[model samples]
Target: MTDDIRVLVIDDDFRVAGLHRDAVASVPGFTPLEAVHTLDAARQALRAHQPDLLLVDAYLPDGDGIRFVADTERDAFVLSAATDAVTVRRAINAGALAYLAKPFDAVALVDRLRRYARMRNLLGGDAALTQERIDRALSIMAGGAEPATVSRSATEQLILDGLGDDDEASAAEVAERVGISRATAQRHLAALATRGQVEVRLRYGTTGRPEHRYVRVGKR
Candidate 1:
């Protein structure tokens, strides 16, 4: 599994930032480091943590976020309620990878984050890169991208879809969800773990054999 993209949530509203952090954790390839409410704290966090992504808001109690986004070198995405054309243009001009309006769906945000991860993987993971592959990855980030589909059996896809939240699941739980026998589900999940699409860890009991829990591949 790839390293989870560490995220810093910068928003004035504590509740909103907490929600965003939870949303980030629910995504496969993202993990929230911390949430800060003011520009000073954000700057201190940026220096201390050096996160891979910044989910920033346009309004801050200490300072405006427009200049901050424009000047920051890290990858930034704007999630703000400010829907004015000027704010939108400024966010784009400030090099935001994605500008999600307020009240957006968490699923939609996860999709975009997956796209961003795909692009980064294409550029950083591939040893032999090509123009076509680069274009395809960039297209994904540009929102005209194809779905990140894989060739697998229908049952396998169903299991993968069921793990979208990327939470750890036991074989019995997966069997219930996929309408399969526990043995079959465990077999499939173990195979996926071998293929690096899932991760398996043992949970010890007080007085029995350890139980295996599986999670979708990511930094957990």
Candidate 2:
């Protein structure tokens, strides 16, 4: 892995900031910087560290954290107890990569961090972006709602069933196993992957080309 993605957490609550910092450090690819309790301190840390990402709360002692994200124009995601529509809209318009409501479980925060890591993994090159690549990155950033919140079709369920635990197979292989066309298999796999129900790994062969292989990840 390359240098860990450095993170700065900003919140007015000292305990919450510490919790968030610890959580960020627990993730595989992330390194949490010292957490800041005010937008003023956050600004100083930003200048000093220029971290790859920021985890910001909506309210800060000095100013609005979402506004701070906008002012910094850095890669930021919001974790706040603020549930107002206007605040959400501000986050959306401010270009927050993702947002999580406060009082969330550790698993939920871990899921978001992992999803962000996956997006960075996918779009990690300087080459020109293709539509497919852009779409895949966007899907990942969307951080699909949990399975219980998303209704799945019968075919999608069948596709999920085709991949056994510890199995990683290409869409074409899954198509063959599920008696579906490769295109259909690819489409459904992409959807499942976006929803965090499956993980995508790139298999490089002797030909030097990479093939995407999917592994079951989330619940049924």
Q: List model 2 lDDT by residue over 1-220, tens digit each.
A: 2578999999888988888888888987689999988888988998899999999999887888898889888889999998899999999899899889998887787777877875675466586754544554576578642223223475576677567633688997676444445897899999988989899999889996899999998532
Clashing pairs in 2: none
Query: CA lDDT, every prediction?
Result: 0.77, 0.79
Against the true structure, candidate 1 reaches a TM-score of 0.64
**Whole-model lDDT for model 2 versus the true structure?**
0.79
Least accurate 10 contiguous residues by lDDT in model 1: 145-154
Worst lDDT run of 10 residues, candidate 2, spans 143-152
How many clashes does each candidate structure show, in the order listed?
0, 0
TM-score: which candidate is best? 2
lDDT of 1 by residue, 188-213 (tens): 88788889988888999998899998
Task: Provide TM-scores for the models.
Answer: 0.64, 0.66
